[model samples]
Target: MTESTIITDNFLLSNKKAVLLYHEYAKHLPVIDFHNHLSPLQIAEDKKFDNLTDIWLKGDHYKWRAMRALGVDERFITGQASDEEKFKAWAEVVPATLRNPLFHWTHMELKNPFGINSYLNKDSADRIYLQANERLAQDEFSARSLLKNFKVEMLSTTDDPCDDLTHHQQLIKEGYEIKVKPSFRPDKVFMIGEPVTFKAYLKVLGQKAGVEITTIASLLEALKNRVDFFALQQCSISDHGLSTLPTHFTLSLAQEQEFKTFLKSDQAVFSDPDAFAGFILTELCKMYHERNWVQQFHVGAIRNNNPRMLHKLGPDTGFDSIGDYKHAENLTAFLSHLNLTDQLAQTVVYNLNPADNEVIATMLGNFADGRIKGKMQFGSGWWFLDQKDGIEKQLNALSNMGVVSTFIGMLTDSRSFLSYSRHEYFRRIMCNLFGSEMEAGLLPDDEKWVGEMIQNICYYNAKNYFGLNRG
Candidate 1:
């Protein structure tokens, strides 16, 4: 009947007694997004999208997986369906997504963007969808507008060594107001002998760096050149996505040569994946040390084996599943190996399995050594846990076991522009968590004190920790 109240002055700060405090604390804080999957090219080009669907729906595996789990057909999720049809299908699935985080996030997006609150389903689908599409057609909904609306002051985008970073350069030249920096992601280089994609990467890296990648030494040199190129473009973070921690190992010169020889011979190292992974991770860590960069380990994900779905839809199309990882002991050993030699970079550890949250959170403090205020961090509630419940739990775990002031706030970790709503979601959850705590007397009742905590969690902490905005 009427427009939904999108984001009220106190929407997230709804616990009336604490509402004033939240508003006072969170309103003017700057955003420091240290890790995400945002595309630097879009920010550089200051591109405008054709419509809302392309910005919100395309390239979001989190939404794609939810749609798949709701039994929406692949055509709507990943195939050639028209935007209207896809939105309609998504509308039908929205109500059924109750008790899921998607339920809340979808409504939030709809309410914030189109000012609609009626449930998205068969009855209201057409009217609501058309209005949202009309808003998308307006000039105010461009990519730059979206970022500014979300108050995204600083954003980091995941990048690969083979990238030329023309987009990053363009963004700097154009003098856009927001900060968009690249973070190196080197998973492709380590997928060697895995029977999937390393060979292709070899050819590409060779072409980009002008080197023969037949030997591990040459490959390292090529990767080094690319890293230098990225650093010149202002990239100061590196991300590693691995299934486990690297084990202790000393590679003899002969062994190193043998592994390089095996690669040239096209022999499979899948049988001994751990040893190779260990060596590669060790080498990558040494590179981080040399560059004085922050390193991120997004570990414990098992991915891309579903032949039918992967072939038809492709990687990150919802074929990834969580694994039971023995991370605590192995991770300790791995870090100890680096620590013993003083070779560890400023590191943040992100875990996927919820069961390991406590272990991961506590394990980080074990490596703190007071060298850096928050040297080893339990990264934000990732993938499956990027919601209200997820964010709260992560905040509690970190607050109770470690220092929350050292915590980095929300990251898109998304490939879509509209996914910035995730940051809003996180900020809301942070406000609610702190607000409720204050109400409960678990924390101080003073407005200034509690407000500082909220501001730290939402923005200030990440800014200080990441050394952002020095420019």
Candidate 2:
């Protein structure tokens, strides 16, 4: 039998054309998934999967985007199609997905899981698909089982404050070995001027905290109560998905209080969306620092502009595009406000547009205070850049300008369970990068050290950064 076609060579260490590195170093590193969208409920239940396509292609806008790029129609992208048909469509698109990381990842998933050597295409789709579906039918391919299979040590799920986290609580009660924590995302809570939606969220928060949020102070108090609740449940991070860092302008407590008054008033226009948005982001960041939690800012995504899609599908449905903003100066202004303050917490900034990668990567170094190591970070190339070119470019920029050793690795940022294939995709890309570097004689010929470095970027940095320990 032929061995599966691995994307990178295992023995190509340090360009010396010698020395096979032990793959053991790759095996032991713990995964610190600092950002992701994995379902906490499925994790809590350890639910098994029925087939590969259901997990891989369904609801994955990332894959959908690529499939669309390949001329696959919306009927297959988001329409009602059988799982098998979708798989076949995806398989048909697989070979053409070349020069795209999905092609490599599809093969990686096949080799790593099913140990199948055949490439996914029209000719091989049926046999390969059936074999994987057979494996999925077994109990081992469940959600939690998949996490364990990929050696995910820590997973941070993005959640809104309206979430009750009953599932998170259940996972803790069962003492699940993996660390599945919540990252507080309060975007909806801060949209106060929009009466219909804001009032609804206020009610949700108010009901959950059992507080009457009639004033700005009361609203903050309600949010604080929820933050405390999340803390008790092992959440130590707050995530902000904003258009940019909050503007440096600060409202006086009295002025902010008055804004709350405006929220309750019927005269406030829903236009000029940032009135409450800017105020709430500033206050939330302050709260983040007060709690000494690591705050993550995933900024620069221009989302949901397609009216037709927005009307039908809702957010995160592939309509979001990269924004071309002045990220550096704005970031400098935002950090300048908090850099000297004692309330400043460790922060990570991820840019959606890769052209800004070098700019943001360098900007992070400017804010590092020697007071704490890794006080600031340019987060991994996210969203569209999660692919091979994306990860490689991020690694190069970070390694050249900042320390790659301090870098934390990949996050799924996905809603689908099969997206864990991303970890495999990331690992192979990392291994190939390191292996190719070793072959070029630019780095040392020490396989063990190189392997460890690869593992750290793939896993260890995130594990230690989040303090998620399984031992």
Q: Which candidate leads the pack in lDDT?
A: 1
* lDDT, model 1: 0.77
Least accurate 10 contiguous residues by lDDT in model 2: 11-20
Q: Number of clashes in model 1?
A: 0
lDDT by candidate, in order shown: 0.77, 0.75
Off by over 4 Å in 1: 1-9, 12-14
Candidate 2's displacement at residue 214, Å, is: 2.3
Residue 125 local lDDT, model 2: 82
Write down the TM-score of every candidate. 0.93, 0.90
Top-TM-score candidate index: 1
Can you write out model 1's per-residue Cα lDDT over 180-264, one digit (the tens) per residue? 8888888887775555477778889889998888776787788888888888888889998887786754566776777676766
Give, for candidate 1, the lowest lDDT window spanning 10 residues. 1-10
